[model samples]
Target: MNSGIGPMVKSQSSIPLYAIILILCLIAIIGGYFLSKKYPLNTNELKAIFEKEDGESNDITEPSGDIGNSYAAIDSSGVESGEHGHYATPLSQVNKHNIDEVFHVAGELVDYDTADQVCKQYGARLASYDELLHAYQHGAEWCNYGWSQNQTAYYPTQKKTWERLQYGKTELEKTMCGVPGLNGGRFKKNMKFNVNCFGKRPDKPDTDFVHPKLPKKPTKEQSKEELKHFDDLVVIPYNRKRWSRKDYEPHPV
Candidate 1:
């Protein structure tokens, strides 16, 4: 029953298992080297990939310092652009008449016409009723009422809503007497109100980049000097002699 051809056929078909494994290892090494060269990985990227493979979130890792600093720089620039975020300051704190779109001019109460002219001189328009409300919501405080758009007037009070309620008045009732229950009160056109103007700050070239009006960042030495002469730097109120009140309270509508 034995056939001599059967043994010959079995011998020809047999191949070494070690040789097959060695060939496959070479192919894998060559492919991996080319892939790594084509798409290089950063430390963070590698870490993210490994973490993802391990069933963890890549967000667990914090951004590097350089990335964080870049974000900080963007935020600083956004403030100059008057973007509605952390950089927007209260109108009271705005010293420049038109530094960042919305700014106020503290002057003797002037009629609506005069306020319009004053704002015009600075290439700005009087803040509208909504604009005034926005400033109030953003924490602007001035005892002297300001001329708002559409022949209206507005001012911010330090009293919180609850405090006003305790005084038998609601904040809305106290805020906009002109609208009856809304935001602003109608005032005589001839009466004077401080002017708050809204517009874009002019852009100027800085080195190679164009930038809006920017407050200079003081150095360590400049900070010390400024702190030493803080009082000298502050301008006294124009009507301080006539208006002896240091804390200006909101007047009744």
Candidate 2:
């Protein structure tokens, strides 16, 4: 029946198959091109884009010219800056403010005026020498106070410190060089002393400071060592508690 037309029909079927193959090949090529470009552009292009965008930004500007030349720091140099702490002192407990507690937790401040002011902002403060020592112990034991009965850890000793509750001041001594509580001379008339805590160490300078209207206490020759030691006074950490006999079991006086 057909003749030449039948053969052409068969050829047309093969043409459709070839067309499908070509379409698939094109799609694969296109997919590969996109897949290869998935990563971000190279550094040069990124730098260019960044520079272009940065050039458009204008907010606060840096200081210019002579304005920088006239600037100076008003603060006096060589004074204590931040909270004082021991070598074993962990940063988490340092508060340059008041220690409000009676028993002196590691960070309690002894004064409300200076140290306490800074610490109250964050609910922390300077620790008393003993408290500071305890805090140092906490640091050595990773702040774990439980099961701590070691004498070496409970006392100051830079020579010995381990995973125990050692409160020795060897490390603390180096860190708390001239701090008020650490290197204090002795207790004064108004000073509240904890004989139980600080042993019999006088908490204030043995001699008295001269008030313009008041009389002087001791001359350098009278107690020269104490006067010399006074110069070494550094800011010592302390607790804010004013202990009375009632506060302690046997009376803390």
The per-prediction CA RMSD against the true structure, in angstroms, equals 20.6, 22.4
What digit string (tens of lDDT, one per residue) describes model 1 on residues 104-155?
A: 5553568987888767765678878666555445444333466778888765
lDDT for model 1: 0.50
State the TM-score for model 2: 0.17
Candidate 1 ranges beyond 4 A from true positions: 1-99, 158-184, 200-253
Q: Which stretches of candidate 2 lie over 4 Å from their true place?
A: 1-112, 139-157, 160-253
* Best candidate according to lDDT: 1
Give the top-scoring candidate (TM-score).
1
**Model 2: how far residue 178 lies from native, Å:** 8.6
Work out the TM-score per prediction.
0.33, 0.17
